[model samples]
Target chain A: MENEFLPRRVRIEETKMMTSLEKWFKLDAQLDFKPGQFLEISVAGAGEAPISICSWNGVEICVRKVGRVSSALHQREKGDFIGIRGPYGNGFPMKEIEGEKLILVAGGLGMAPLRSVLQYVLKNRKKYGEVTFFYGIKCLEMMLFRDELLKLMEEENVNLHIAYEIEDEEIRNLKKRFPERFHKGMVTTLFEKVKVNTESFVVVCGPPIMYKFVLKKMEELGFYKERIYMTLERRMKCGTGKCRHCVVGIGSSSKLICRDGPVFSAIDAELIRELV
Target chain B: MKFLKLKKDQIEDFFDSIHSFGIVYAPVKSDGKISFRRAQNFSDVSLEYTRSQIPPKHVILPMEEPILKFREEEYFEVVDDENKVLLGVHHCDIIAFKMLDEVYLQPPKDIYYHERIKRTLIIGLSCIPDNYCFCKATNSFYTSDGFDIFLHDCGDFYFVRVATPRGLKVTENSKNLFEKVDEKDMELFVKAEKERFERVKGKNLWMIGDLIELRDENFWKIFSERCLNCGNCTLVCPTCQCFEVYDELEEDLKSGNRFRRWDSCMLRAHGLVADGHNFRERTEERLRNRLSCKLGEMRCVGCGRCTVYCPTGIDILEIVRALKE
Candidate 1:
């Protein structure tokens, strides 16, 4: 039996500084992972954190220095080896909504998983319909993949709208960089600026506090509950579903976010009231 | 069921026979408390225990279990093996293993736990619940399976039933010490195993299928009022599988082992996630989640460990019993 908890030490092939808090680590390991699936990266004595696979080939983990494990990861330089186990959890349902218009939404650090989903869709651009990506972060100083976001604007049939909650010198600098793409309010403000079809498939990933307001705004704008997909966050230990820490139940339905989902429909999403 | 009979006096021979298989552990009286310990002497193995102070689950999921022993790329899975024969396990514990097995042995299986299960054999004892035991009310009163063998203390003689091939092989060593149980002895053994169940049924009439129904602020006030948050209940639990894993560097500094230690939801740090979001920040919320999660009917296996070891005597069963009102 393969020990799921044992992490394989993989050398960091490349490292990129996206922002002060977030750094992207490209690992020298070929993992067959779905775009939005996650890998539990261990930093020896510091411990492990569940990081979403952010790149196309699935080795890159765009992580924020939010906790101990990630902070330890940020301290490590290129060519350093970190323990990794997974490419675990169900990713975004690409096949289910194939050829349908895709509205990708994210808030703050939530952009990590949505970036993987959007990049995969862009790989075979003709297979999907119009793709509108909406994102929001605290300020411009927290921006990640600025070069990549700018390059994505050149892609045909793709629309991008980004918002900053706090206005400062960083916001003015970002406005000078991409005047048309930047907005001045929360992610909810993007809906009025860019119109997506009411029946189009929507994917939303964000911090816990953003779910209620974002989902409510999407609902008021006529987006159906079943059409909205989301990735949930919980205190996950053993990602194999052994630990009950990540168990979230709604009504008669319950799912181990590690196993059954990190991805859930808005109907079942309502059941996990703790996220609200 | 294959039944064999042995006198209470002849039980020493059974313990003696157990040594050849492996180390045998049973209930022992030390420091005025009964805990499961190595049965070094047959005279010390006590079956008079209503329930053990510490569950035999530690034999599988220890307080600190190593997952990996590593030095960068060259790492090996750290696994501990011991051919253990655990004695004096009650019906509640047998039921508890079923729930723990569901968590560890199911797909996306835990190999560390699987390796331990392979090396261990359970020898069960029939339980007589005192006023404190509420296993029967949760519909986990008895288990016909899980252990390799089950022993019923039938007055003058001991009735033994072999439930597995491993058990039958162990019992074959001392075939001469046993006699076939008659129909009369079988009836008495079955009746005693089931009779105490009725007394516990009406105590907890709380509906748990939907958790929102059981929520009352007064119940929270009362349950958390005495809860010292010592986590003695989770430590003694046979079904609580929540663990926190971290690495400990050895003296060499180059290599170390990653340890998965038992963690409890009752702790303040248990619910704190990345980005500093605390799901259960309030004292009552943490207290409520533990009861609510178990009420969904998965984690708790009806072993009243928390109640038995609670310092302030906060009976979760009685608190749940009041929830019915």
Candidate 2:
């Protein structure tokens, strides 16, 4: 009962300045949570917000200053205290899709959650076949986790594709750092570059507008919708299903995105609202 | 079946007898609006009312509640509600509580809500449908369970059925107040039940096939029109249980409480992502979401609070009825 609303105080081990708007926080307390799961972090003045786990070795979450909670988190330095709860929501079913190819996509901050799978796949490299990650962000300033991304590019049997909407000096540095892996357009352009076969499995996370275009492109390229996966986000208050703020109706029956899913197969994405 | 008879003259004594159960809240009319208030005296309780403007669900999940208290980055307490007994709850609203139980009392159940439920007793009343009432249409007017006691109004007396053991004990303690019902009393009770059920038999607005086919985008805009997104509909609804959580700090910034307040999808920001993207951008989309959530294939208990409380007089049932066109 106490665990329902009580959050443990976790100290920030270290903080890396990703960009002006984003920062990476490494927690001293490592929680027993799977890849693709997220934690609700609450500060004093700002309320709780869900941040996706990007690291498998430690408790690391990437925070983007898009709202009040994250903005308040951005101001804090290393060793500051923050309230934490969860490892909530079903993560990517790694064991189910084993021995198959993977197509991982990340748009802007979407990279944070997908990075969890990226690290997990790299560790168990033989369990998966051709693994590809398509990461795209606006311009170059919003691009996150650059040092680790460059390390991922060098790994054998793993391919990292990067795209920038607009060019900047930071993007040029990234192009030089990863060499031939960088592209000049949106992430949709990366699909044209991919040799998407029947065996390839897909995991996608992005802004709400990105799903329609990305899914359409995947279908056009002979990618099966059943094998594709997505993580849907809503204004979730209670990570559990008690608060109905995160509910999305699929036909007549309703499902809470927090409890029923944050990770859903592409076919199951019907539970979320789509823009026409 | 555990029926007990309380004469019309003994209703006042019946209210006085319930104190040992918990603090009692019954429907009362104040400022030209009906609401649940603590029964200081039974004379203030309205027995002839159609429905209270707000459902008694607030007793379980309040509009605002302090869930956690923290001081200097350390949590010290989790607040829980005291014992309560809700009086004059309608059968439809009783059904709504069951739906709420399905949501909050499931696995990894809400501790705060379960704590509240453990301490509360429900007393249900049977209602004859009014102009704005549509519980019969939703098939929720008749409740078999989910209440401690159910009071069915019969002429010259109230037929009270003690549904739970706790209710039986309470009734037994007040044995002097109730008389054994005769054959004539049973006949009158059956007649009232038949008449109430027959009046709203053919006027159902909820059909699964009609709801599925009402997907025209042009039709959706009509829903948000002649309207304000004041969220009064969801606020007044017994089944609408969405909420938003916030953290408040003292001026010194050392201590504060984390609380949750009722929220509605009708608000433009209800679907806002943490990264600051509002998914339900248009008012039409917001309205579509609530309607789909309310009646799309899901069971509507048809409390009719939304229709009664809409300042713009947006009849949600009329829109569903229009779906046939």
Candidate 3:
């Protein structure tokens, strides 16, 4: 047999330093990817790493320089080519929540993938019920996509709430720029203040630890397991199912994250011991 | 149809004749244990050996084969190799390879695996019952359908049975190496083989049905403590086919090759993520996955190769028994 898989080289058009550790890259092509699906990004000699596509419409990835591949990506400039394999893994199941209210919760870099779904909802606003966005970060400096988010929040029929963990001077000064958008507390605390309907479809993405706490709050707030969804991250070697690197515990069987899901309903994921 | 009656001394001549056909590999003694290697003489082949330290899968699916090569600006191309023969394969190993063939050559065929597989011929030797073997439990101790040629060792001679066209061709070419078999010789060979397997069954290793049912039982905590997490069981297992892929590049960063290597679920990092989350972090969880893959998955064809190669001699059968309790 012969290997049939292919790798495509895509050019990065623009780069924005989202935070101290994270940078956003806008590529030249409109990569047909769903929200919460990730791309296996390769930097020739360094290594290949999987990065979730944080922005839709345009292909962009918010990469944190944590490992060799991510660090190499941070050092690269615009017009450089990066090998991309896929927009793999199951993304947010928007079809199941089409007619329900939407609640989006993102913590720190979690906003990256969720930003895609949030953008989709905004572009097709009339298709869904009330939309509420709750985003939290470490400090004012760590907040990403500030200008674009500000413009999005200003748009009619959108309700956006932001929070930070820090009580620093820079945050105090920046609080004046958007008085209504800023709040100081943990992201889960904001859940109590927001009004959510019983039929609301909640989408959550964040560090695994943060999701545990936030998901508990959502459950307490009367959200059924079926109405909640989460995007989980795992080490993926081949975005295709051949490598078998990204199998996650789902119910009684191990589900390949590349094929079965990166996005799973809370009910489907509840039996997974590690996720809980 | 004929029965080969070559004295033990003439085994060397038999191997020399087969070598003219193509590359023939057999288990040879290395570091006091038998390992499958290129055979130059019959003295190097061990027909009475228990099992090879490594599975025969490597002869078909190499550990680190470059599936494809690509240039940055040009289209990618795959690599394929052909024409090889593996000799003296144990019954369990043959069954294990058959399982691999089903997986890799199934729908959405793995081209790389198929290229090597199609080029190779399998020559199997019926195994004498060993202390560690539990192949009977997995119903793979002896396979009548998998091998191209099956050889039964009878005191001073080899009873060769050709099963495939390739096996028949090999026999036809070595037409001078056999004599017509009589009913007396066949009866004696069958009686000896049955007695050999019956001795193995008397060891109580074959009664593992109750243990198999308790594979998912929560008694793994007790059994997991002994697991060194060394990953010896998975590496030696013929049917364990999990893998990890990565890319290597030239220093100039202008070109690179994506490659995949064998990976085991027994390791901690196998289940780790880029975002600092690991699902099977604990040793127990890793152990559970390993057991589930072997027993619960029902994928293991009961090769008994894992038990033979395990350094600690961790009897998976014993673990199953503990689970039953």
Where does candidate 1 clash, by residue pair? Answer: none
In the predicted model 2, the residue pairs found to clash are none
User: Candidate 1 local accuracy as lDDT?
Assistant: 0.79
Residue-level lDDT tens digits of model 2 in A126-161: 899988889998866678887777777787767889
Model 3 chain A lowest lDDT segment of ten: A245-254
**Number of the top-ranking candidate, with DockQ as the measure:** 2
**Residue A205 CA displacement from its true place in model 3, Å:** 1.5
Candidate 1 structure quality by residue, lDDT tens digits, A87-128: 889988888888888898899888988888887888878898
TM-score of each: 0.95, 0.95, 0.86
lDDT score for residue A268 of model 1: 75
Please give the distance, in angstroms, between residue A126's alpha carbon in candidate 3 and its true position after superposition. 3.1
Summarize candidate 1's per-residue lDDT along B1-325 as a digit string, tens digits: 6888778888888888878887787888888777888888988877877777778888778888888888854468978777888888888887888788888899878888887887788888876667677675566777788989888877777778889999888888778777888998888776765575654444453456464334666658777877777778788887788898887887876688888889988887787788778776766766777776665554566767788788999877776656665
Q: Tens digits of per-residue lDDT for model 3 on B1-325? A: 3344445566666677777666888888889877778888777778787777777777776677664454552336455665666888887788888787766765446777777777677777867666777667666767776777777777877667678887777776777776567786688668767876784542233333334433453566666677777888887788877876666665665566767678888888898876666878888778767766666555565656666666666677777667555
**Candidate 2 chain A: 10-residue stretch with minimal lDDT:** A267-276
Sorted on DockQ, highest at the top, how do the candidates line up?
2, 1, 3
**Native interface contact recovery, all models:** 0.48, 0.62, 0.41
